[model samples]
Target: MLARLLATAAVGGVVGFIVFHPREAEATGPTATVDADEAQRWLLGGNAWFVKGGRHVGDTSVERRTAVAPSQAPSCTILTCADSRVPPEHLFHAGLGDMFTVRVAGNVAEPVTTGSIEYAVEHLGTQLVVVMGHERCGAVKAALSDASLGPNLDALLALIRPGIGEIEDLDEAVRANVHAQVAGLRRSAILHHAEAEGTLTLLAAYYDLDTGVVTFLDSPPTSAVAEAAASPRTPAEGHAPTH
Candidate 1:
């Protein structure tokens, strides 16, 4: 599968060139080695507060904006759906320059998206990369059926098809796509080196529209999957099924 994944990238052309490039990126400041565990803790805590109707913890003030103007030292990079309801900053209570985010229809990890991720992990010193799949995603729904939307959207849906082969359930298919994206990203030689040296981490996540909670959907251990199941959510926090 790994070989096949790289072969797909090579045949596609862009990712093959970008993945094996010899250039390395240097962090602008210290603390660039912020580990994935620490970043995940901060994100989860912020999300819990968001669900509980607490105040936003992220600073979006002028001072904060000016500080990060020259360079950004975000702890993580998030790639999620371009769906309006799944806004990363609002969902996570993140401020300006807090995290680098890549938003597209299906959160697909193709050559261009993967290349952007490579920049963040290699040059920006980001420690964590999250590929988030949410409930009731329209892109997944369209891909599950044989609907011809248009040329651009059709191309986008085609990228998501293989990840969700033979799956009929929308929620299950969404999770499957997330795992498939993570696998494709992990095969990058640059990312492979970072993981091999214990510097970078790639993981999948799920967001519940009702609960406003983000669940880490990685290969779980120590009963985290059960412990982090859906919790009671507020009526106001629940979205109106826009996703």
Candidate 2:
């Protein structure tokens, strides 16, 4: 049964699962002790470098490549839209083995995506999880339309609809969508347990296409005030494609 399931996952070519029981509660890595603050700072610094066209591409040297070929230890997990323009690595100026990314249309959290995230949190030593929404998201925009969609697409639209509320503004709805994904992620037992243990931090962010700015949204207890709070915005790299 396990072999069959793994085979099916491989055929789908969407999410590939590795069945392994993690040892202990601590993240495993050379830099396993990286806390939530350091993860956030690293992302911010990467974005700064990216915006300035000084992207420090990861250690692509043959020796360095061979070193990490044995294993990966990403510091963060980013759940972002599948928009071709919003590649998480480019936005954060990351290189190979630096980040574990989960991408889906509208960046909505569904079972498959959630499962991938759980795998990262449980096995990849990732301390930070960012659910990012971008400007002019097509998925959110479609929710505002009455156009008929196929069952699969309709299901995706349904997940994004509630986030939009009654707001007609696209940008506002996009931010709301990020908050919604963050909430959905919290429903995962693995994620919730990690956060409760102070080993994880969940964040929401918005990526503006025009300015390449990524503004971190305030988290819970302050989430209600996120829209109003003046957040520190960093210039992100890359252009976002409509997903």
Candidate 3:
């Protein structure tokens, strides 16, 4: 897919030539060695731009496509919910090949997902992992309500149930579930070693559907305190769910 896009860029004329020659290199900058703090700050800036209706630079340009054709070294890996409204690339105003994203219904990290994250960190040199949960997520709502579901869905929700106890509000449950997923991710030895060695940082975040805002929950509370700590908060804390 990346190769095809690059081919089109190669033949696309003056604009293509400019995009191919110098612009691509300058825009994509080698992400292989980006530090966790720099990567997270970049994502936060992009999210702020998205909330302000700013256009993403060089995202779908032919030059960008061509530059990343040979290889991809995304700076961060995002584990977010499968909500259509919260596409990670779009929410963060990131370009193609800039973010390695893994999407599941509730943003839960099972063995498969954890393995993928490990690969991104160990192989691709991705520095940051953002586990993003969103407001009014259908999967979360179903799990919180204990809605009768098919066997497959029931099993998936069971993974989420351990995180949410008696949290009645949908938003609060969503937050707790994020922490729970973080806890699950911490169990990965690969991730543990990376964090210990200062090569990786795992973060929790929340997305608001209506406001197009993403809030990074810095130093998220541990799972032991996740349920107990969730409480109503003002907009600054990213607790007010517009949806």
TM-score, per-candidate, Cα-based: 0.78, 0.77, 0.77
Runs off by more than 4 Å, candidate 1: 1-31, 221-243
Question: Which residue pairs overlap in candidate 3's backbone?
Answer: none
lDDT of 2 by residue, 11-74 (tens): 1111111111111111223334455665665566555445555545443456544444545566
Across 143-184, the per-residue lDDT of candidate 1 in tens digits comes to 999989999999999989999999999999999999988888
Candidate RMSDs in order: 12.0, 10.0, 11.1
Report how far off residue 214 is in candidate 1 (Å).
0.4
Q: What RMSD value applies to candidate 1?
A: 12.0
Query: Which pairs of residues collide in candidate 2?
Result: none
Q: Candidate 3 — what's its lDDT?
A: 0.68
Backbone clashes per model, in order?
A: 0, 0, 0
Candidate 3 regions off by >4 Å? 1-31, 220-243
Error of 1 at 139 (Å): 0.5
Model 1, global lDDT: 0.69
Against the unseen true structure, what C-alpha lDDT does each candidate score?
A: 0.69, 0.67, 0.68
Q: Candidate 1, after superposition: displacement of residue 196 in Å? A: 2.0
